[model samples]
Target: MAHDHHEHDDSCGDECGHNHDHSHEHNPTDELVTVRDLIRYATSRFNRNKLVFGHGLQDAYDEAVYLVLHTLHLPIDRLEPFLDACIPTDERTEVLEIIHRRSDERIPAAYLTGEAWLGEFRFTVDERVIIPRSFCAEALADGLSPWIDDASQVTRALDLCTGSGCLAIVMAHCFPSAQIDAIDLSPDALEVARINVEDYGLQDSIRLIQSDVFSALKDERYDLIVSNPPYVTAASVDALPPEYLHEPAMALGAGEDGMEIVRRILRDAHQRLTPNGILLIEVGHNRAEFEAAFPALEPVWLTTTSEEEKLLLLRADQLAA
Candidate 1:
């Protein structure tokens, strides 16, 4: 897939661009443009522009409300009840601008607002890291509980390429007795991770390290290792929607074949895994390529409602060669 950046010069007309004036009353401002009204309008606009794939109008509305409430630092639960709660003129203007940016420039709400929530952990986000929406969160929330027979037996866990520290935090919460090593290659990405670590009060349980894959890991071993690495191939990268443009290229593209990172992870995983260690990685629709790369290994494929995701569960004993 091609990794070229999509650029918009903001040349679209008022109806389609950011220049539309949302200030005037005569602008068809939904008579009672409550918080609900604003959300509806934003959702309609986003759906019309195809911002979300397979998501219905209601999904779009919820997402828009989510972004708006998140941008204002309000809880999502408080949104519906406060629909008619007067929004200051300045705040309304700011929100309109954000909606415009989303509709016209195609910037993702997470990137535009610089924040995202994964499970219960909310992290500071930006173009430096991809938005945290991994199915791993679901697995982790279920106690990570279903996967392990004895949580207390887990001494160490690894959140490889930790990004914004969402997985690491979730692991920390799930396995209170386990210490987590959150590793990432990019310093900028690590900065975001640090914020989340501190935010979740897991600084002591989760150790943030700057290293490329197993380089900083050295002789360290872990009972559990989880990763949601970049798996987008050159072709898939080219076909991604405009919202994907808001994410960093390095956080999405995995080279020509897209197995560059996964291959490396598989090669080095055995050395870092303890006797009964488990490795869970999200391959996200690249399962065919992954299976083709490691034909000798039979990885347990896991699925979710999201069509793009394909998680694989591997054990250290299976990797013993």
Candidate 2:
């Protein structure tokens, strides 16, 4: 499950006769008129340039539609009604410029748009924080059922590597009575998280802290701890596409095998978890390495709509053992 880049056909430009020349810029005022025209051109341009699209949307068409609709200040979900509508010259240029930056500079759509969505929740985002994408969001939305029989019972929780504090805010919604702590090593990321927490009016329920893993939490304990830490291996991080390079590298790479931070979390988690507390962590595609690193401990893999075994749950007793 590679997360950074998606494979695209290299022969498309040759087969479709679209000029691959990077020097010649297309004049949107002359060539593009309608919203449909802009979407078509942006999608084709992105496909020809082989732009990566893992930040928020999946394929070229979806990203193009989102960008055009967003640039025009139109409703993103109702694209069919405005497809034939003519775009004003200034708005058209604005759309074209954004599309060019996306294709030419390879900036992730979230960074370009300044916001990202996880499920139905939206958060402010920029280059300071990794775009919020985690299976932990889904698990939390489901109230982490079966294991977490009652959401209100969770009086306190923690979100480690909490970039933009997206998941921590989600935790506030899921467990309304719970006090949440969100931690990240980068102060810039913490600042972004602070914005999101305030945006959601969660300043009282959610707290943002800067720390290298759990270093700053001296005697704090929690009924639940969740983390979507940096798990990309050094090799994988080095090979990521240009779009991923826009994000902070420290938020992506963990070490040679991607288990460095995971090791630190495991070593200290038991001491900070309440007797009946639970821990959930997302490792993306590094489960194999995680199992290899800790063969003795067994954790229950939680199911989510998006991926298989991307998240794991460990009980306090299991962690103690």
Candidate 3:
């Protein structure tokens, strides 16, 4: 259960030592023939091993389908059309080996595949950044309606703890007129974010900066400031599943009670926001601690498709007052 490891270049073959010649036939089992069979096998193994999910997917079946489809180069979204189709002998080995590594090593699927999706946006990911799973993506996709009133008026935005720059890229698309500054404390995480920003051809729209929160942007104010900061408490981080440990340690945990980074954001947000600017932060499962920390401030809780009260929204005026 070692957390400090790099992704293999050969798709787990570096550790397994399996050949990947798809044309060559080599079968380890007679049962795992069709895509359906492989999915069933992988799902059974995942459940039996008590593998953890939630990097992007929710359960064993979803993870099996995703890995099977991704391994075969099939459409990740469409599984029915290819469910009964027979998988070739060599390809079956490749797929099974991936399944074995997943069950045994407890590697998150995104790390194995080297990619992740937030809505229709696909990002190149690795161990450097935590997988892009944020409730903020849902809010940004909806244009933060009623709260913002108009998306075009958002002239400038900031994405704090912009690991993988996924939210920043999404913001670029959602608020086309806005200039986004995406900041992360880790230089390695910033490198991954740079790749993602460049992949979306958002080089001009999203600017990646290595900053400890807002320290790098002196006096620069934003119409919208959004963060999915490290809110996992120390105890929670310690008890996280092996899959969760695959993510960067610095990107996951705050101090005790998980409000260390959050406290800093709140302290300086009022100064860095425009008069009517909005501040949004995703404090995953820390509402009780959030309320305890700042009992005087009332934030409008935003709901996503997955969870109720997943994010908090505050206006600049509220913060200043």
Candidate 4:
């Protein structure tokens, strides 16, 4: 499905939001607070409450810090200097109200804050689109260097099933010469993508289209084509945590084996790629299924720090549509 950006470090129990153990030394109404103090208390509350950590940060400490700093409009990476800076009384109250909502409502930190991070780039996110948590973001940040033979040759690109337009925007930023077409089936997701596209001021470089996949592209070809299409199985969707339930299912479930959308992409991509074009798709946890599904064509698997990434690369000729 979508790159959920979940960490395996902790799982959200079914009743995670229902139980809260208030054993922390700091209360929400504690007097005389600093950014560091607020983060500490929120982390403790998060861990004590046993909520899931994924949508943004992997641990309570980092997530809490992000929540506090982002909420206050402080630079998150520059927190070392402002750890002890006393938070304004009113700001502290506003911060805790959200911190409480984060745990109590069982919503993702991104959805709660209405923003998500794909590396340093920020996007406006809500329930309409899946959080911008694809490993492709990291892959793009590396300039897609390891796989692409020549980045300079990548003049035209396509971002299929480009939820929130994260991949398209990031790729456009990384590959300055490239013009990317981002297509998705859902209007709601496209609306969210449109916001991020406009926010990044890339309307000229990136175009958003509402298409199921390559249906609207016709004979258009690209030097690079990338997709993070829905690849989650029906079984997995049913088993996903409630935090995942907040995301749109269209961005999640595929067919019985989770190969429904990916299969079509593989079959149709050859017609849309240049002779030397490269196709990169994130299959996520369906690595084995993908390998088995396409037994003859060998895909160059790309690795990322996030375990959820099962990125594979193939050339246009290898696809042979």
The order by descending lDDT is: 3, 2, 4, 1
How well does each candidate superpose onto the true structure, as a TM-score?
Answer: 0.85, 0.90, 0.91, 0.87
The model with the greatest lDDT is 3
Per-residue lDDT value at 98 in model 2: 98
How big is the positional error of residue 250 in model 1, measured in Å on the Cα after superposition?
Answer: 0.9
Candidate 4, residue 87: CA error in Å? 3.2
TM-score of 3: 0.91
State the TM-score for model 4: 0.87
Model 2's C-alpha root-mean-square deviation from the true structure amounts to 8.0
Error of 1 at 113 (Å): 2.4
Q: Scored by Cα lDDT, where does model 2 land? A: 0.88
Among residues 3 or more apart in sequence or in different chains, the pairs in candidate 1 whose N, CA or C atoms overlap within 3 Å are 1-234, 1-235, 2-234
Model 1, span 1-321: residue lDDT tens: 122332433222234323445676554543323465577778888889877532111367777887676655555655445565445556666777788887889877777777777755677888877788887877766655455787787889999988888899889988899999999899988999898888888888999999888887768999999999899999999988877877888888998778889988999899989998999998888888888889999987766656654888889998987
TM-score of 1: 0.85
What's the count of clashing pairs in each model shown? Answer: 3, 0, 0, 1
* Residue 183 Cα positional deviation in candidate 2, in Å, after optimal superposition: 0.7
lDDT of 3 by residue, 157-271 (tens): 9999999999999999989999999999999999999999888899999888999998888899999999999999999998999999889999989999999999999999999
Candidate 3 residue pairs that clash? none
Give the per-residue lDDT digits (tens) of candidate 2, residues 1-321: 112222432222223323334467855345566788789999999999999888768899999999998888776776766776666678888999999999999999898899998988889999999999889999888789888899989999999999999999999999999999999999999999999999999999998988898899889999999999999999999899999999999889999999999999998999879999999999988889999999988999877875568998998888784
